[model samples]
Target chain A: MAVINNKNGLRIEKADITLGFIPLTDCAPLVIAHEKGYFRNEGLNVTLSREASWAGIRDKVGLGILDGAQMLASIPVASRLGIGGPKIDMISAMVLDLNGNAITVNNDLYEHLYAIDPRSEFSPLIAAQALQCVIEENKRSKRPKLRFGVVYPCSTQSYELRYWLASAGIDPDRDIEIVVIPPPKMVTAMTDGDIHGFCVGEPWNTLAVQQQLGHVVATKYQLWNNSPEKVFAVSESWANENPVTHQAILRALLKACIWLDKKENRKTTAKMISQAPYIALPEETVALSLQGLSLKHHGQLPEKVEDFHVFHRYSANFPWLNHAEWFISQMYRWGQLTTPINIEETVAAVYKPALFRIAAAAIGLESPSIDRKTEGNLHEKNMLMKSQHIGPNQFLDGQVISVGGIIKYLEQQSLSKADIPALRLINIQKEA
Target chain B: MKVLLIDIDDTRANKLEPILAWTGIELIKLNNHNTDIYQLVGEMHPEIILVDTNSPNRDTLEHLAQLNKASPRTVIKLGNARSESINRLAADAGISIYAIDNIPTKLLQSLIDITLSYFYSIEHLRSEIQSLKPEIDARQVLNNAKKFITETYGLTEEQATDLLSKNANRQGRTITEVARQLVETGSFI
Candidate 1:
């Protein structure tokens, strides 16, 4: 690529570009980057296109129609593994945000669970156990399987929903039905009785609770503290051809994320993204969660969960290899991917920590020195007060996965269809 | 063979239905956004599905193809030779194609070619009419300007044309713009 230095003194390969984003609150980084002049600060002209669906975004990026996009964190990995959609080589150097999705059950389902066990309102585990009882009763009555909606087939929401369902011995595939619905239409689908519950990002979950149509059963934060939700991904070939341009975009997004993490700026961020060209929702609905209020129940004050949407704090922007492995492990556990491949090699190709380090360093920010870390090891004490570099990483089931222990982690998950021996044999061969 | 046309509006679907009728291809048009796509695809078992590239229903169709391995999957791996045409199919026609594995590649290619030509023809006529209207309107304005100049100033048609051209060149504007302004205001700025 020819390097042309702009007036800003950055050697940008391609300055005029178009990016795609779905109308979710986590699309904040890209929107803020464009709205706040961060992209322009880096001598780049960017257009943010509002996409109708994740599939459309994926295909456009694959076909080079879009320069890059805000994608579900699992999409790049799934795209590489050829799991749910077309096999396209995609990569991400930075994670946009973490832990902004929640699972909501319709009012009737919530009432049933509450009737079975009152503690279900306070505890996600208790709610799942109660749901087990409700499922049993529905089975005895021979009613059709309750349908649950997710944003995409190979999405973080899908895996989180399955992880929550499998917590109480409910087979997500056999015990209930799972369908894909776009985020914008989620609440309307629930109102029309097309789905009994759904797992999606805000402000759909907040909108559902506000309309009194559903109650939040569990949140992605509660399921896995500070898990990755959305990422900034581009085609691998695009990254190779425009390395400087990619880094420029990443640096701009990092600046946007740093600005988003500040408490005072969040209200304005919410109001800005709620305009007609972006999310196009009411400011209050979008502001509730962006301002760190988890509105899980109607007719009650929203709980203050300050880390509800972590844009930059706690090394959140770093694209850890272990996170990519977690997504791959989920794909195997759910039988979405039946083949066994080298997990380390695949993640190394898809999640470029080396690139993230470069971008983070350019802005004089501190990133994690290592690319992999043990999950489910941090407690509240380790991550409290915002003094630590990394935040609490705990799983609801309290399963700890070592750096190279993804196969072992997959072996422990219930309702998993993974072939451990096969996986182990292939990975060991690759290691040798 | 069963072919499902999803989210194609009435006008386009009407044009495609007849072209596909005589080829032994049964076309099923689904434009409703609220339909249970998974259930419909499962029962109908369409060998080929064509959906709008930007349709909100595309995600559900993707999920359906993923959940059922035997179902009609997206034609993603049409080899390096056909990828350019696939890009054209998406960028030009705004369509995404899905078909079962056993479908012949030649048949798929012909279907894509047919759809692309159909869209191009319609687009061609639409643009032609759009381009012609402004020219016709410009001619009417120029004639009106010339008649007013000849009747008011006692100048011949050639003199009026020369006068308008001189003013258009002096103002660095198109003749149509100067004529429209003259006809509207009875004088040029």
Candidate 2:
């Protein structure tokens, strides 16, 4: 492998590193970095290990067993706040990708939803309200509650699923059950009648739809456009100790993201990631997200979504502090966090946009100059402008998640004193 | 009465159900095999968890860690003999007792007793070590040994720690004992 000198004159602390990733289409950047010799060009040896679950990724990264990992966008924030897992002071300087997740419901649920509303537009609110009807019927009939699956308790899938449901007046806590099912087993679980629906990343969603086990109700793009999905995360201590290495990794990943965004390269990238060592799914299944084709539903016509997955376009790699705050607000809104936390401090400690800026600048990539932006206020007129701002990032309910808005939202929800036992059940672990 | 059995296939369940029944440990077997094991354990409030599988995966151990957080329970894993590193990983992931390979049904009860006693003693020692100064030096030595093993064998830090513990168990010694040997020799088998 050819080695290039550090052009930025920064000392590389560690040349050899191992990064962890769950087997999913969104882990493409890390795989592309290693396979395309991006890491080798910077004088680094990168080993990409396929992790079993998000929790395993969190634990291994937290314990310093692995240097860094492709983590759930909320994992670092939740870990820092000590909400769903151990407090590990994790940080993410760059986001891996955006909006590669979809909500998939089993065939039975899909039929029920379609029967309720056979509309062409895949509106999350409409689907959620139909789900509300199913939930009420189940309650009235004294049947077992409908169980839905998210990849992790502290994940974008969890928040998005909850947000979408709550928008339709369905109480996620009492109306149904939410469980964590690893992405790989989601289709099987849905087929086994273990879960009625799940919100997860591709190609699991695509795979389920293709297998005729489920249908896509809504993509994350429909719920919240270009929402932060997976992030490249490491412990804060790891970053402090290996600043140069971290920057180098970030630069390589940014280049990979750039390489991935080219429409012509999507086919090859899809084929590359579908190998057994990487995502291990069919190339066609992985290609569906990359080619930006309409996702096929069980009964409804395919929905054409162009921004299904954005890797480098519109400064998608930059870690936004506001995104972190939005997650914190969601955590509070859903009763995952019962105590008030300083959102500014948590964002400062976990979302390091300055580091991302340095890496982007070093690689001659233009990143968002500003570190924060108000979410849920994008219009088509300003969509193509090349500024630090990127959007179409609106919530289904049209509620803006600004700093003050989150504060007011949390206060209105009274999450600090909610004291819901079912909410607290998942967080039973003693602090380590 | 709160006992949870996970991944216990019908064959093992058939063999183990009678044994557990005789002991009056009402086993609440998990039927949903795809849900998060840790979250299920949290919801069920199982005081004791028994997992039977071919080998424990990273998900299993990670869930065990989560289970420990919600409520520390006596966990027993019965399966085929995995690599020493895997056994070590299982232990680190919070399985109190990891019994590799099948054992005669007659010895199962006695094994449980010994495992319970062993867990208590280790917990007692852990608390004592938490308050001692020498423990810090020992930890440093262990850390150095783990680093050495990781660099030399190209194993992950978790895997290296597992190897050390596995060696210690095989030699009928403690982790500190095996760590000292690795630290002194600067090599691990």
Candidate 3:
């Protein structure tokens, strides 16, 4: 039921909307759309709400107090599966940004890991292995389990933190206590000795390093190259009702993402998002990662790691169904989601690739013809030139999840609690 | 039954304290934002916890509800069973409710209705006072304008009122507007 304005040649179901966002650097898409008049250009009045927590954003969006929000990539899927929270039918049509999170450990823990293996600072896997040795020694001496922090129970940071630990044979649940801390409180918690390490989105990691409170042990990009991070999500009911307005928002975000990805605009973005109403951190702290510099250690020069915070390149905005499957796989592996479900059908319901295609096509961009693709197969050499439909998708442990092979991938994961046979039965039933 | 209120204003909490106390509901108010929510919730084990919807501590509480059975989980279904009431609770009251499992929806609804009416009454009085403020100010302006008219033109109070009414009727404006104009500008065109 879209009512068109003949004068403007655009029809918006709901013109005035309030969208929620945490004060993170990746919230640039929503902020840019609002600040740069992209929303106004589309004849939409969008008020960007600076939310306090992911749970606040999730609940507000669920209750329709928010029209939509920038959310963790796993939220819509997790909410749909009723894992880690109440069941809420949510969907995401666009990925906001990719690989903006990092795992940081307190200076004392970092020193312990570094003493075991000097290369821990350079390699995520080696850092995990070194941390494993430290964990073993602590257990032998009857020390308490190391506590880690994440932004949410079902966030991508939680999954990434677990995946990094499991790479070195450390069980996240059994070996360490993972606590949920608000992103802004993460550095304070680390300083107060409450959490030894945390995996969160920037610029908290940057702030911790600047304060000499922590050292970056592993980054999300190193865990899985260019993996999906934050996404623009809305409740399924809201999308169904405001189809036209949703499309308009998607268009505005896409344009903003394109403008953000250019190398020259990175500094301006850092400065813009660092304002009082946005991330509110110093521009230099937010500028490091946005400018492709990965600061892993204190009293050292930051490493040049391009793609540290990918906004648009490499078909990053496409809501890949396989990416949704990966989050579900982690949920199952961690025992956060136990009930068997049709993996393909579930991912399709949560990630709207068809809607993404419509939005992409209207902007004269080419989306991948297929909804799902094999992850962790493409490397840097293969993606040297500009690619319209693919990007670097390699994992830290060299694990590749071929299309429709999520169950097989989960079966091979270390410390997995997934019942592969039951999952297969559900998938087979769906196909039949 | 124990209920914890986090970040509610002191005056409102004080008003709510005795009202809830009469029903044997012990209310513990947590005003410090720096308090460790997990440790407090673990120790207090309150059946129902009320907090602002936008509080930064809500996420840590959500994590606690996910990991610990003793902690109160969010009351999502209350918003679902009767959305209108829940919307008013969130939008007007700006509060979110979390309660342990098996708390009946009817009980929660009644609690919400009580809280809503309490806030509504306070809000009702505040708004009533708010609406009356302009009238009081206008009366002052009218009196000052009458005095100005009497002192400058040697007109009677009735004559001043008649002149203001005439100007208001001619300009199709409120008498207050004409009176304010004369009081501020010392002239009514």
**Which 10-residue window in model 2 chain A sums to the lowest lDDT?**
A423-432
The DockQ of each candidate is 0.54, 0.07, 0.56
- What CA RMSD would you report for each candidate? 6.2, 15.2, 5.6
Question: Best to worst by lDDT, what's the order?
Answer: 1, 3, 2
Per-residue error for A256 in candidate 2, Å, reads 0.4
lDDT of 2 by residue, B1-189 (tens): 555666556654555566567767787775465556656655776655555422223334433443245453222222322223323333333322222123343354454554344445567798887889688888998998998888888999999988998898888988987898888977543
Top of the candidates by lDDT: 1
- For model 1, residues A320-423, the per-residue Cα lDDT tens digits are 99999999999999999888898889999999999999888888988899999999998766755665367888998989988888888898999899989999
- Per-model tally of clashing residue pairs: 0, 4, 0
Between candidates 2 and 3, name the one with more favorable DockQ: 3
What is the DockQ of the complex in model 1?
0.54
Which of the two candidates, 1 or 2, achieves a greater TM-score against the reference? 1
All candidates: TM-score: 0.88, 0.72, 0.89
The candidate that wins on TM-score is 3
Error of 1 at B187 (Å): 30
State each model's CA lDDT, in order. 0.91, 0.74, 0.89
- Stretches off by above 4 angstroms in model 2 are A1-5, A299-301, A381-389, A409-432, B1-189
Q: For candidate 3, lDDT tens digit of each residue in A257-371? A: 9999888999999999999998998999999999999999999999998889988888899999999999999999998888889988899899999998888888888888988
- Classify candidate 1 by CAPRI docking class: medium
| Candidate 3 regions with alpha-carbon error over 4 angstroms | A1-8, A381-388, A429-432, B79-82, B125-189
Candidate 1 residue-wise lDDT, B108-135, digit = tens? 8888778777767878999999999988
Evaluation by TM-score, superior candidate among 2 and 3? 3
